[model samples]
Target: AEECINSKIHEIKTLEQVIGKLITRYNVLEENKLKSLVNIYEKMKPKDAARTLNELEMPTLLAVVKHMKDSRTAPIMAEMDSIKAKALTVELVTRNRLPFATAGSGEGDG
Candidate 1:
């Protein structure tokens, strides 16, 4: 019985190790997929990209935008629907993660 228990423990340990590796592989693939999406967005015009991006879940959209250059992302933001653009801008501001200044209400008027 003791030997059987030891064997079971070993099997459990092996399974745990395999699970850990699988989780790591899954995460890597997900990261790569996000990177590929970012690359595709970077290649598209801001207006076109914004239209397509509107269909993405907010977290996924944020992840892609987070990887983009601020200059590039700004144009995309400008092209996006105002409500969505405002929501994303607010989220970024609240997280203290935005890299560039958002245009304020009439702040630029001379």
Candidate 2:
């Protein structure tokens, strides 16, 4: 009985390691996709992008904003609805504390 239990434990540990590896791979893929989306948004006109972005769910918008550079994020943000912009800024600065918060704070944007 003890030997059987030990074998089961070993199998569980191996499965756990495999699960961890899969999760890491999934995260890398998700990051890559987010980067691609940000690149597309960067190339778009801010007002047009803002109009499109306004329709996205908040979590998706959050991910896009988090991945974006200050210059790319700023104009779109400027064109967003005022309440939405304020809400997103609060979420970004307070919740995530993403580097984007400080990067554009005293902007001489390029």
Candidate 3:
């Protein structure tokens, strides 16, 4: 029983390390994909980019905006549909705001 337990524990540890490496690899791949997309957007003219961007769903659009440089993003936003641009900006700001707001609230709990 003791040896079996030890073996199981070792197996669990090995599985955890494998899971950690997989997560790291996944994150790197996602970052690279985001960078590649940002490059594609940056290379397009603002109006063309806006038209392409308009077809993307909101979450995908927000993810692109998050990774994109502000200088490049600004021109695209200017060319985008005003209503869509405003909504995207609001969603981006909300994503950033949640963490800070939650952290600030937690500090006073002590």
Candidate 4:
């Protein structure tokens, strides 16, 4: 009975570990999907791109803004309607000013 209980506990622990790993993997996969989508949108014309970016969730918008190069971002921001551009500019500036937040960190923080 003792051996059986121990074996069952070991199985449960293994299952828990597997579940944790799977959840982490899924989150990574979801992030990648969002990144790819943003990349596709970025490649579009500025007007179309701005519209697409506006449609995205705030978190996703932040991610896309973080990934964008300054040159590309400037042009995209310039092309967007004033209200949208202003909002995005604020986000970009805020993201730049803060060192700890944003997507990938270190070195080129923004």
Clashes of each: 0, 0, 0, 0
Best candidate (score: lDDT):
3
What lDDT is reached at residue 12 by model 2?
A: 100
lDDT of 2: 0.90
Choose 1 or 2, whichever is better by lDDT.
Answer: 2
lDDT of 2 at 45: 97
Clashing pairs in 3: none
Per-residue accuracy of model 4 over 1-110 as CA lDDT, tens digit each: 99999999999999999999999999999889877876786688877787777676766677887877676777777776787777777876776674555456556655
Candidate 2 clashing pairs?
none
lDDT of 2 by residue, 1-110 (tens): 99999999999999999999999999999999889988999999999999988888888999899888998899999999998998888887777666566677566844
Q: Where is model 2 more than 4 Å wrong at Cα? A: 97-110
Ranking by TM-score: 3, 2, 1, 4
Residue pairs in steric clash, candidate 4? none
Regions more than 4 Å wrong, model 4: 1-9, 93-110
Q: Candidate 1, residues 11-84: lDDT per residue as tens digits? A: 99999999999999999999999888899998899999999887777787889998888888989989999988
Full-model lDDT for every candidate? 0.86, 0.90, 0.91, 0.77
Number of the top-ranking candidate, with TM-score as the measure: 3
